[model samples]
Target: MRHDPLFERLWDGTAQMEEWTAAVSHGAITHVADNIITVHTTYFCGSVTAIRTSEGLVLIDTAKPETAKQTLDVIRSWDDSPIHTVIFTHGHIDHTSGITVIDQEADARGLARPRIVAHRNVKRRMERYEASHGYNSIAQSQQFNKPGYIYPIGQRRPDAVYDDTLSLSVGGERIELFHGRGETDDATFVWLPERRVLASGDFVIWVFPNAGNPRKVQRYAADWATALRRMEALAPAVLIPGHGPVVFGEERAAEMLRHGAEALEHLVRETLALLNRGASLDAVLHAVKVPEAYLGKPYLAAKYDDPEFLVRGIYHFYAGWFDGDAAHLKPPRTADLASELAALAGGAEKLAERATHLSEAGNFRLAVQLVEFASAAAPDDRAIQAIRAAVLRKSIENENSLMGKAFLAVYAREAEQRSKG
Candidate 1:
């Protein structure tokens, strides 16, 4: 394997990865090992791993369609081997949408189309995605801060699907696939025993694991921890993660795997302990906090998903959506409730004014809630809309998680538009 100085620094933990984007965004092709190369297109896009076998090239993932051409070009520059196999770690659009480009490339080159493989649930997920395209588009727009992001409806079905575990011998190297419920139920992480490399899908992202995305489906925190433990047991020398730079060296990769698993396990244990004590969801949400020890680790920072959100998800996983509040079990319509609250407070304008005061006092959380009620009570009120927008802007500024910030930003933008009207 050719040695690179940057890779050496990263492998030995000498690199300063305090800035996550700086660590993950290689922005080009990185020669990982003798026959392995990692194509890191962008921070948001998933990284693609190309493994060269005696027979052909095997791609662990294909990035989003927007970066497909560039990703392909990067891969071609490294090794123009006929891609015999393409693996989908999950059915997320960012990881799987680029298959069309690969298919077209194969057709143009007069080579056989790469065989696509994924967990069985990925096929079902793709079907669900097509059915919920419109809703997903709106959710994506809000989550990604894109004004009018449209989720592509159709996704190509995988050529083959496996359940639990599957092993394949490609080019005399044993490649094993294991199913784990992490960021998605359909997640699969590939293990190359010969090279001691683990192609971890979104399971091993650079930031805190996205075990709870408020805008998306459920995530299996416990299962994700178990998967990481399983990977750690393999003792892989190289780890090609789903979205970050390729991790080189066994102990360094093992440390990352262990820390990530422990972080998720801690959250799961603490949240469940609170729930088991018959605590209300509201109580659990506020009480269970991410340990500072975990947050201090650069890899475990709450940049993409908040721990509070994960606690809510855990509550949903074990308990019901009722939050153990009788009033919430059979609540009044939001608009009706907001209107009543406004009336009790003397008017929507009064609520808006109070929201502004709370925001100015550095209580953006409570300020946003009050502003939301004011807006719901008087959706057409310019003063309320302006206040709502202002409060949300402050909330966004105070937010740490990208997902939370984007959602708040979306609401702020809408409120700003309403204020203009």
Candidate 2:
């Protein structure tokens, strides 16, 4: 019911995203409490929080490496206090990679590098990032629709790692870090008991929780719900999420946390029920839906991660990769299948023509499938490639979520290139 300008701009279609970009570039710093300030960044609505302590400053999370300097500058403007400690809520590049700039700033000030704290699993996550750097790079580029967008591999190692919970006294103010499995296996939520402020890493991001990124690593929906409930129990007066705007007001914060947790819990429960009933993965995906009560909630909109993807993630977590479809158990190569389909449809050109018609008719989902089949069967057909590109471009225009738009844009670009070749 409350007005959220950021959410409004984000969902207002890509053409009007200049305002959102401007918001991130400006990095507005807002003081939520006596000494706590939140810096909202342009990088995916990433946020960095700073707490002025008696000794120095304590920061929770950091912006991405490229934009880290902007975040640091905003904090410096508020207080030039040397950063005593930095807490990484997760190992995501956007959260951890920004430490590089912070380190640089500390060095310039001739102050000791701040102690970096994170979950014990962060080191392993970093190592995995390095090992699978290429795969992650491609996946991230596609996910964000940025071609050649390199995923940050090397991250500043944590000076201290905690398994469950760790308590620290910074400038006589108590800060608690709790490990929770959510968007990532290594996730931490920072709590300031005295200030009643909670910095929920990616777990409480404003956009549908991101618990169902279809292309990324495994997400912990059940654990994510549990963590949200824990935050709700705290009833934080100020809630600063990893991304999006800072939430103020104890009642409002509690409701957001409770409703977010409830949405995930509902999906998990419905998904598990379908699994327990021996429903196929496809059946589960189609059957399990976010309750109608939660659908229109501004926080729970399917702007980024859709409910269907969450259902699939839950199915994979509980039932492994098998979808119970015999044809897919040992499926033929996609190209081979496409070739046969093309033959049955008379020719690849026929399929391409039909795909064009579907695209014009605004049936993008099926249109994309038909176009892909034609392209696979006739990889060198210029007409089919052009048709595929056109259809994907239409899909991109129709997409509401940034992730979906990015993926469709990438496909459209690739198809366009193939057509030109």
Candidate 3:
């Protein structure tokens, strides 16, 4: 409470976010009726999406493992009805963790262990958790709200897996699973033929697709584009996205998918062109542009993932690490260089002052860039705390996207803790 800039900035952003944030719409557990009971997940907690058919209930995505009890609480609210089947759209912790809870509940209550469905690659993806969980933590630290974050690791893996495609008949309802390479290598989107509901998973987030989560591992912008196009083709009337409110009607669904698809395609097309032209990584990063044409598209607007992250992701997708120079191969340690930068900027205090000024002037991105160096060099400085708070506040003001808001919130909080001590 000394200053509370980080939380203040985030709070301000949330206040101004009515236009960008998906209308709550009982997203915590909204029931979308279209011969299908689509349970829309909220932002913080896990959501259990289910489709009841004559054959059985086809549940898409279990909840988080730690919150599986809470997820069960939500599910029980809807129906004490047994979970018939589940489709893990990807192997991410948020989507895959709650399977066993649902499974255990179903079993104890004399319900069948829902046919766990997922892409074949999900096994290998899960193995990453088993093999290098520490590595996952480091990588995920950038995007996730660290304090709010809890890993749901020990859960049952999917029993059924498919590569290109899989078709399931639930109580005479046909649900098609298409393998999609997006945010992760093992991703899938479900298409229901009879009900006209598509469980798009993370493939079509209400805001922008998360193709550019700054700290996460490799993300597929092009492949994400491919998947979005595949989803658009189905022309489902209702869309139950992995996060956010359920989108109703074919027209809205088409527009959402189309806008998201075009944005990714635009970024990928331009990024690939820059790479093909022998531009330096820095040059390619700078040269890539989010098309002016698509800027006005509602879903295409920068809200969750920005084009910069996508450009960097695509750069890695093609170039593979080396930035076309030898010096980067043996780059200086981050702290050492940061110390030098702080000194050159006339110490952390001077940089902090400049950052505060820049924040006042509406240059939050640049302000954070400068302060990150100062903060890293002088981690214990109270001046760094004030600057970080200012940067966070400005970031909230300038943030056209959720990615910016989240990144700003995280670092600001970290700086606040440093300030506390």
Candidate 4:
């Protein structure tokens, strides 16, 4: 295999943080170990792993619909083995959407289709998605910053479903699939006992685990941490993560897993402690800080999901939806409150001016709050609309995670359109 400097640095644990991000976005295939080929599919898309076995290739994840064909093509170029089995790390579209392409390819080659495997809850999750198609469509669109992008409701169903643990042997290699609840309820992480290579599907994303996605369903932070520790126990020599660069050494892989688990564990423990004392969600969200030990680690970067967001998800997992604030239990409509505030501040325009001042003073969080009120109060005021758009744009600049940026981008666009009107 040709040598890749970035891949080498990643393997040697010398790659810079920016290089790690670059590796995830760069669609490249690297043979990290014997019988293990990792494909970095595309920017912001899930990865595909192909394990060359004596029988055939055992594939894990097929990437998203857009990059699935390319992912398979790259794998096929390396080896023309028929895919014996395709395992889903979870039911997420990015992981499951490529099965259709794989099936079609098998038919074209006159080969038998691969058996699909996933946790039983994957089917239930798919059913729920189908039932709430409209809502998912909108939510996904907003999440990805793709307007009018309909969520792909029709996904290839799993042929075999396991509840807790499933073991498979193909061509003399032992592959163990353990059900883990992390980014999703039906998450799975694969372990190759023979090679000691762990394929952590979304469970060990290169960035901070997506355990606290604000726009998604409830993420199990405690369970996610446990899963990481479980993977760490295996002392995998190599780690092929769901999205980023591969880890080469046993010590490096174990440390990364341990750090990820520790970060989530810290959040869960601290957040629950505050909640137990009857602290409000707002107080807990601000008070619970990410551990200093995990800071500056390449794998624990908050580029995708922030730690504060994780705290919110932790609150949701243990406590109910109510944030312990009585005012929020059955709060007045936001527009009503915004109108009253605008009137109290003389007018919406005056509030917009104050928001501009706050924004200029580097107080973007408060600036957006004020501008949103102004926009809501005087919807027809072009000045207020412009100010809202500007403030939201500034917030987007200040944000680190894609979730925050995408959501803020949505509101900014709305304000921009309204400002024109």
lDDT of model 2, residue 243: 80
CA lDDT, candidate 3, residue 410: 75
For model 3, name the residue pairs that clash. Answer: 54-171, 55-171, 303-402
**Ranking by TM-score, best first?**
1, 4, 2, 3
Q: What RMSD does each model have against the real structure?
A: 2.3, 2.8, 6.7, 2.2
Q: Write the per-residue lDDT of candidate 2 for residues 169-204, one digit (tens) a residue.
A: 989889999999988999999998888889998887
- Cand. 3 TM to true fold: 0.83
TM-score of each: 0.95, 0.93, 0.83, 0.95
lDDT scores of the candidates, listed in order? 0.87, 0.85, 0.73, 0.87
- Give the per-residue lDDT digits (tens) of candidate 4, residues 259-320: 99999989999998999999999999889999766866767878788899999999988998
- For lDDT, candidate 3 versus 4, the one ahead is 4
In angstroms, the error of model 3 at 139 is 5.3
Which residues of candidate 2, in runs, are more than 4 Å off? 1-21, 43-45
Judging by lDDT, tell me the better candidate of 1 and 2.
1
Regions of model 1 farther than 4 Å from truth: 1-27
